[model samples]
Target chain A: MARLNVNPTRMELLNLKTRTKSAKRGHKLLKDKQDGLMKTFMEIVKEAKSLRKEVEEKLSKAFKNFMQASSMMTPEVLESALLYPSAKVELEVKTKNVMSVYIPYFNLKQEGDILNYGYLQTSGELDISLSAFQELFPSLIKLAEIEKQAERLAAELETTRRRVNALEHKLIPDLEDTLKFITMKLDEAERATKVGTMRVKAMIEAAEAAEAAEAAAAV
Target chain B: MKNNYSIAIVGNKETILGFKALGLKTFNANTTEETVKILFELKKQEIVVDEKTGETKPEYAIIFVTEDLAMGISKDDYKKLSQQALPAIVPVPGSKGATNYGIRRIGQIVEQAVGSDIFKE
Candidate 1:
């Protein structure tokens, strides 16, 4: 820790003491913030992981069905089949602040069923895949929300942790070092002054005694 | 706060149809350039805030990209896009099998914060 370059005066010492107090207070607050951010970040990470696993499983299953359905039909026919979407998945995003991080929440308004394609040449697997996707859409959106939350929270947590570390390791110690150095300097100066005054008094008394002895010898 | 953001998916005709059936706006991206272009376009949306309610929101909330297409986005762009507030870009399984890109990307995020690859063990 580097000593702060300030004049070693009583005024400077008092100012340093106040600064050290506030730095410690700020450090405590930052440490608490770090803990709070960590706790929130952990919760969000766990939720994101589970939700991600579920979404991945559902997506792969849906993709499998899609693969099968696409294999049975020609490219042109498959392209023409799902060209136009039947229903709409209405969405509105809302966000909540978690430890200063804005995490989004999606409100889905599910409308009619997805049945725009005629049931003629389409394979049953296509229907199954489309329905699977339809059902999983909301979950997908939920996954997005949680994952994004995790990302944002993690970032905030990182910054808070770094700040806490700087206070705990660097700034606080530096302040303490500066405070100690100033107090020591002030104490040394005080002692030096005391010694100098005592010597002066002794010399003056010695001179007076010499004059008194001179007077006695003259008498 | 309330927002008018929507989710989107970008991929080929076959891969995106499933998402379209679910009512997400699906974009057909034949090449990596097309996919990246679409993502940039989505990111270009300006955030709108209501003067009366003080509620703020953006247009695109999330964009799901197929892994094959996601692979085309440079690491820099991917990092930049993921680090933003709105429009969380995520990758999912397409017609092919699992790629684990999404899991790995999220793992990177976790590692960046926690200072360890806790996702693996």
Candidate 2:
């Protein structure tokens, strides 16, 4: 693979080295973040599983109670009694930053207070069933929150994981390999120059010795 | 970012085996002594405990334990584990378990209202 022209000079090499180290540090931190997010997601999944179970059970029981109440009373009377006049519940949606990610929160009119209105004056059994449904409402909202957050975090975690893997498994290895190759090439060039200079010096010495022997013979 | 915590499971072969496939670090313990030994090892690594209690704490942000094993553990052990504020200890359904009642219930309501099962396979 074609490596980045990282080390143009000594200063550039130093800078590139620093960047490589920073990239590695960033990679590790992102990996940790990814791991943390996954952990959070797993916890949410577990909670969602259990919460879903609890909510479903309560809802089912409430539904059964409603069915019984409806059957006992006249259908017309039960319809009028069980009718929950829809409240104009307006939600002000806003976003908050959690761990650098923006998450939405629904600001309801009554933030944490339960608003009991339509079914308060109903029959005893019907009232109890409605209260049960009311009790399960917060958990149902919570389940929605957990599931949403889990989905967002899971997506972010997957992206971070991919980036970390790329840096660790591909980019860093390629850069190091290129640096090694260049260093080896430079060393080989230097060695060849030294060998050539020694050969020249040896040739000069041999020529001088032959000339000296010729002069001695002449004398 | 600050601490590195790990989840280690100590249970019968099948229990830990399923968790391993879920990317959890598990320790199989056939005996109580082995369970304690593995728990101690995880503690030393600062992976399981909060560095105070020697018990098997919920690290990894969540711990899954079988209902049978959860009953065997003491209340004090649970209290100490709770202190870490780590992952919640959840009881997973074993093989041959029915659909989670909560999920099924919610799914049923949605299915009825919309004429489609939201959680259907």
Candidate 3:
């Protein structure tokens, strides 16, 4: 129902018609893009859900084991045992495009064992905890990957949805309305011109008849 | 260029210093401003490009922020950082003890992934 400030002319009408056509085309393309984004987004979310559950379960177990180990060991012994780490992890991170959004790819290269503590000083639970932690490292990274990917996709989905809605609800409708207004105006102008021509023809015929009657009277 | 992903821990001095012994980098930030600055700096690291393939990679792959310090930041700022794909901002426990923040984050991710809050607690 919003009216555009435009002079209703044939040229403007033609231009608006073309614009509406392109707008419809653009709307369709954007809708398709949104659908594609949502499909991929959902798939990533599903993967992330399972991955999160696994990581959380393992991490909690690891934390519990660590607490148990800490309880058994003396403070000094525990401090020294974990002071020097034996494991070295080099992470290789790259990004791949999912739709228009770039999501991270994490690859870890781990060197050395995680057990740096001596058996004589630390309890078996301590060892178990450390090993569990080492095992959780990659899964942690993978969880980061999946979660980050989901976030990026979610942000994109929000933006795309906004654009699609704008085109579908506001822009396209406005253009169509403007085109209709222009067409109506042009048709009214054409009809007015036709009526004016007929009126001028009648006036000329009436003048000719009057002149002929006056000539007959003079005769 | 080191071909290894750099890791960083951000939190208060006492909590983050422990991570240094493990060969990971640590950033001590007490205020939300400081934490936000550190996060931005880490994300803005120059991308390394491979000579042959022309592929670029991030300098920092994972950044762990203590839950308490992370909570000090505004919600919008935290959400923005989380949405970024590079340098994933992970919340961890500080020295005081574990808050459920880390677990809750994972749970939220689960909900986002699964389209519902399936986790009971």
Candidate 4:
């Protein structure tokens, strides 16, 4: 890190001292925040991983049934069957702050029967597939909510980590260098003034003693 | 922070019908442009203003797009979709089969956040 390009004055040194003090404080606080964020992030990631696995497994099973059902019926009949669903599902989103990250919570609300279509047009496999998806819907929303939370928390943790590193390594060191330079400069200046005054006083004293001796000789 | 947010899915006829049966809203996109358009529309729906923060946000809580269509979205649009805090864009496999993109995306997010591949082992 480069020393701050500030004039070597006592005022500059005082300013630098304050800056370093604040930087240290900020670093400590950010380190704590980073630790908190990381702990929460790790927990969220673990939960999301397990949920994703379960969701993926269930989804595949439902998809397989869908594929089988699609094969058993004509394209026109299948399209007509699922084109207009009579039921509706909605989501309610709420967030709780964890380490300043707004982690989303999804509450799923379903209205009416999903199997509103007549049984004559659709096959038995289709029924199984739809019901499987019905069971899987809530879990799917929950997975999305948790995964998004993990992403947000991780991102925040990374930013905090960077800030902490900057303060601890770069900014604090630079401030110290500037403060040192100013202090040494002030000390050197003070010593030079003291020595100059002492030398002048010694020369004046010697001149006065010579004049007094000359006057005595003349008398 | 809002109520009555919608959950929707976008994919082809074969993939979307299954979710359609589950009563979630479904949008069928046959082409890349169409898929991008539908996503744009979904992103623009139901704007809500937060009373405390006075910030406007979309009301789409979750939008599940098939991996096939999501991969086809142009680079810029993909960025737009991912950047939104609301309406988490999740990718699922279509009728063709599981491509593992869904799982890989979560890993990617983790790696990006950590700045290293923590799951390398």
Candidate 5:
């Protein structure tokens, strides 16, 4: 029965060596990418954790303030005050690319009842709070964007890690082993050829010496 | 091909427990003989052979083995398992071990970023 055999050329071995080196380098880089991505991800996770807590606190505060405001003012009066015709708010949302990912940006314009309400028409505190909420909206959007980015990076990191491991542990090692096997076989062949050549040269020299001795003896 | 598959880890008790937390099935192999036995059992469980066609049917995607246990298996055994294409033998970092592998990988990525080389387009 014929068994499978591998015959690798010198050039092929060299190519494999280069490939192995490249694979090793690639493996290292992918690992780094994974780590960097993880670092960024962890940072984002931390930020998100803290931001979520802060947002929850702020929202609670805002709700409490709304309750206080509602309790202090009669519902009908407050409704009538808030019923004033205000400016309409128009929002423009756009996307910007960062590190090969798209993130959103928003621009807002206020027109109708939003601009004409009693709070908008008189007291600046509610208007300030409204603007604060508007600012918070962008931050929340940004948080969501970062969270999405972190998730994508985590997945990419995992994939990269797997590829790097495959190359490092399996493919490159296999190539190197094959290359070594071929190189050793080639070296053995060369050694055998060298020994054969040396023997042939010695035999030729011995034959020439014998012929010279025979000639001397004949003379 | 069915994408759903599971990973099982074989190692020390603590390591196995840690892996179990990660939702992986685990078996403990404290001794070298037990490790070999576990590996053999894992290999047996990993693939089912078709009696009629004499073909092997593979199961599982990967199996993580501790480095110590990994040394007990023969190269031929490793080769046989590799040929199956399922249950890729991955030597994961042990519980007490430093994340040198992860750190090295990260370093490589950083190097690639700085050099902008190593990857072919």
Candidate 6:
């Protein structure tokens, strides 16, 4: 619907042709990028789903034990029992590019026993909950990592989709239209110039013929 | 000073108190506002590292929250947080029981990524 305002000249036509070619190439590349981003995003989504399901199941089991422990023991005792955690975790985070999106990687290093409290003071329920949490460390980290990846991929996918749409729907069409307009204008100009040159030639030939005829008559 | 990387648990005092025994840092946020604020804080809570490439990256790896508190977060905030890879915010059932919020979120993610709810629970 929109076009560049410029005189339709050979130079302009040449430039527009090159621009159209580049735009088409750019469109194809962007479309490929969008497809790649979608593929990656879907993979991450699948992984995140399974990971979340497993982690939720385990965590719920742990919470159930915590509930039982709380019911059996006094609130004050439960609080005192888990006052200081027995385990220490060191987490290292890094990012890697998946398609141009940088997604995070979480690595957890856990040290020492997760059961930090004295057995005499804690119930079996407490033990179960603590162990369940300990077992969940890796899943939790993995969930974090995958979820971030999904987010990044999703974001990239959106951007790529926007670009692809712009090229497919807007830029490419505009360029093509502009190219057509310029070519039509240039052809019309060429036709008009050719017609004018033909008319001049015919007139010159007619005048020469008349002069020659006059010379013969004079002779 | 204790460790460069630590896991933080945010939720009700009753629900997350047990996590303290594991040496994890715990924050009690009873209200939605407080929970969102804590999530934001945790999100922003990262250690900046100077890479050899001269780029700085902030690192804070994992965060766990009770499902009830996680639900308290607004949809937009939850979407933003869940999509992030760092400071992974995991939702555990509180003393009450499993709310299935975590699973549902995953299902939603599947739908968003694949354009269909194929991974329905």
Top candidate on TM-score is 1
DockQ for all candidate structures vs. native? 0.64, 0.03, 0.32, 0.65, 0.01, 0.52
- Sorting all predicted structures by lDDT, with the top scorer first, yields 4, 1, 6, 3, 5, 2
Model 3 Cα lDDT, one tens digit per residue, A108-139:
77777667658898889877767777777778
Q: DockQ order of candidates, best first?
A: 4, 1, 6, 3, 2, 5
Query: Candidate 3 chain A: worst 10 consecutive residues by lDDT?
Result: A52-61
lDDT of 6 by residue, B26-97 (tens): 899887789889888777765545545564333456777788878878879976775655566777777666
Evaluation by lDDT, superior candidate among 3 and 6: 6
Query: What are the lDDT figures for the candidates, one per model?
Result: 0.81, 0.51, 0.74, 0.82, 0.53, 0.76
Cα deviation in Å at residue A185, candidate 3? 1.3
Q: In model 6, which runs have C-alpha deviations exceeding 4 angstroms?
A: A207-219, B1-4, B48-59, B75-85, B107-121
Candidate 2 stretches greater than 4 Å from native:
A1-19, A71-88, A92-94, A105-127, B1-121
Model 6's CAPRI class is: medium
* Better lDDT candidate (3, 5): 3
TM score of chain A per candidate? 0.94, 0.73, 0.92, 0.92, 0.59, 0.88
The native-contact fractions of the candidates, in order shown, are 0.60, 0.04, 0.28, 0.61, 0.00, 0.57
Native A-B contacts reproduced, model 4: 0.61
lDDT of candidate 1 over A43-99, digit per residue (tens)? 878787788888889888898888888888887777787777767665687778876
The per-prediction CA RMSD against the true structure, in angstroms, equals 2.4, 20.5, 4.1, 2.6, 19.5, 3.3
Clashes of 6: 5
Query: In model 2, what is the error at residue B13, expressed in angstroms?
Result: 47
Say which prediction, candidate 2 or candidate 3, comes out ahead on TM-score: 3
Clashing residue pairs in candidate 2 are: A52-B102, A52-B103, A53-B102, B61-B87, B62-B87
**TM-score (all chains, Cα) for each model:** 0.91, 0.53, 0.81, 0.90, 0.43, 0.85
Q: What is the interface RMSD of candidate 6, in Å?
A: 2.5
Relative to the real complex, the DockQ score for model 4 comes to: 0.65
Which 10-residue span in candidate 6 chain B carries the lowest summed lDDT?
A: B51-60
* Model 5: CAPRI class: incorrect
lDDT of 4 by residue, B1-121 (tens): 3467878889998888888877777888988789889988989876647767776777577889888777777767876775656878887777777777777777876776677757644
